[model samples]
Target: MASLTVQFTLRRYVARAYWTAVVMVSVFGTMAADVLHIGLGVPFAVSTPAFLSVPAAVFMLWYPSERTLSIHSIQTRRREAFRWAAALATFALGTAAGDLTATVG
Candidate 1:
């Protein structure tokens, strides 16, 4: 969240702000998945598909509302929200899948 605040504050450093927010969200996403499985005993088998469905649901809602999923077309707040939701879901999905693979295979 702080990284996103910085992203808005520094317009000239767009790349740095973007990357920082990405890294921050990714770290948080991994932590969230870990907490669900390790801290809350969710089980990777469940979490992997659960997290995967989140992005799918997001896209299902996003495309109907926005008419396009291109990152290049993110000129509105609505589109930005969809993009961020997808990103966080994707990162969490990846984390859950990785844990599932490592534990099961």
Candidate 2:
């Protein structure tokens, strides 16, 4: 198990951020392909995770502390900011992955 105090550290945070971005990108790519092939809209596809992740991260960050997400100090504000930033970053990464996958095909 990991320590709570170190959960929001730069290293841990970066690792999580990188993974989330990868996930988003893969999901987006798959969802796009499905849409093109089936012509049916799917709910909670790549975008679904991206959308949920943002709020989920915020909740996690704020809930852990006191409505603030701070990366540097692990305070409420810093945690909140970190959460939001991570979520956005994941979305961007997902977009890139999806785009790359689509472009290649």
Task: Output the number of the TM-score-best candidate.
Answer: 1
Cα error of candidate 1 at position 44, Å: 0.1
Candidate 2 per-residue lDDT over residues 43-85, each given as its tens digit: 3345445544654665666666564443455545365456545
Query: In order, what lDDT does every prediction score?
Result: 0.88, 0.50
Worst 10 residues of 1 by lDDT: 4-13
Off by over 4 Å in 2: 1-75
Per-residue lDDT tens digits for candidate 1, residues 28-100, read 8898899999899999999999999999999999999999999988877677778878988999999999989
TM-scores of the candidates in the order shown? 0.91, 0.31
Which parts of model 1 have CA positions greater than 4 angstroms off?
8-13
- Candidate 1 lDDT score relative to the true structure: 0.88
